[model samples]
Every structure is written in C-alpha cells, then in structure tokens.
Target: MTTVPPEAERLLENEPVMAHFATCADGRPHAAPVWFRYEDDTVEIVTTGRKLENVRENPKVALSIQADDGGDTQWMVTLLGTATIVEDEAETDEARRRINEKYGAPSDAYEENELVRIDVGTASYRTY
Candidate 1:
C-alpha cells in the first residue's frame, strides 16, 4: 500500500467535509457522498444499499474530498484504493463511532450501516 503524503493526510484528517465515494462493478459506476474517517492510511465509511452492494462486487474504489468555503476551492484530494468489507460487528461498531465522532454526530449513529475500510494505494492532492 502506498502511504498517503503527509500534507494530504493533514488535510484529510483535519477537514470534516464529505467524501465522494466511487465504486465500479460490471462496467457500471456508482458514486455517493459519505461521511468518513481517515487514519493510518485507511479510510472507513459506513454505508448500505447500493454503495454496499457495489463494494461487495468490486473491491477497487476511489474517494474524492475537497475543502472549500462558499464557492471558492481550497484543496482537493483523491484516493485510489482497495476496499474490504469488515464483517466483524465489534470492529464495525468501533469504526462507526470514530466516523460519527468526526462528523460530530452521536456515537451510535448509522447503526444499520456496514463498515468498509479502504487501504489507500495512491493519493494525490492539489491546493488552490
């Protein structure tokens, strides 16, 4: 796995912005906004329905995050990675708590969602 650059990691860890999670399966692409937590070169997201199904079908995924104020852009980071569905309930719950805490939501939020961890293989960012 490629390590996330320190500058990009700082932005990823500090920004509470939404990430655009993208997945592809059978030539079709799916993307959705997700609340996520970034730590130790891994990104955790709790999701269900189409997003979850797509990840199951395809472990390869991408995440796009940007920090902006009003209409002005500050920086954007894109990550390409391999995703794994975490089936352990305890691990999923812990991931949920961390993700929720990042977004300032209740610890028990998104109880029905399953956890997916992406091991980042490539990370690129641009600051404007």
Candidate 2:
C-alpha cells in the first residue's frame, strides 16, 4: 500500500473541507461533497444509495478535498483512484466514528444502514 505524505495527510485531516467525489456515467461526471476519514494513508467515505449506485456504474473516479479560504486558497488534492466498495458492519461502525471526529455527527439519527467504504487506490496532490 502507498503511504500519504505529511502534507497530504494534514490536508486530508484538518483542512475542514468536503471532498467532491466524481463518478462518471454515460459521459457525464457526477460530483458530490462528502465527509471522509483517513487511516494509515487510506481514505474512506460513507454513503447510502446514490453514491453506491454511481460507484457500481463506474469504479474509477476523481476526488478533490478543497480547503475553505477566500484569496489564495489553502490547498486542494485531486487525483485518480480505484474505488472498492466495502460492506462490512464493523468497518462501517469505525467509519462512523472517524467521520464524526473529522466532520460532525450524521444528519439522521443513528441507525445501522447499508454503508460503504471507499478505499483510495492511488492518491496524489496538486497545489495552485
């Protein structure tokens, strides 16, 4: 497994930005801002239905976790990665906790639903 650098890790951990994950279908790219978690250089995000459907249609995707700032944006990481859908209860629970610590609590009341894990296949960074 490839390890993320400190800069990349920080940009991921505390940038306080939502990731816009893009999935393409029928020559169209669908983007969604989502909360995610990072563990040992691997990033994981949770989604219920739509994202799953998109992933099912296209396993390859591009992601960008943009930093929130006006002039001179803080940073942005964008690259390609192979997405694998993971449907493990224990893993989802862990994802819940990690996501909470990073972003915030889930919008809906807690209930175990069909959760998925997006493991970063290959991650790279770009600065402007």
Best by lDDT: 1
Ten-residue stretch with the least lDDT total in model 2? 107-116
Per residue, candidate 1 scores C-alpha lDDT tens digits across 1-128 of 44788898887887799999999957888889999999889999999998888888889999999989898999999999999999999999999998899889999988999999999988888899
Error of 2 at 98 (Å): 1.1
lDDT of 2 at 9: 79
- C-alpha lDDT of all candidate models, in order: 0.91, 0.69
- Candidate 2 lDDT (Cα, whole model)? 0.69
Tens-digit lDDT track of model 2 for 24-128 = 867788888877766565667777666778788888877887674576766677756767777777777777776766666764424444454555666667567
| Model 1, global lDDT | 0.91
lDDT at residue 30 of model 2 (Cα atoms):
86
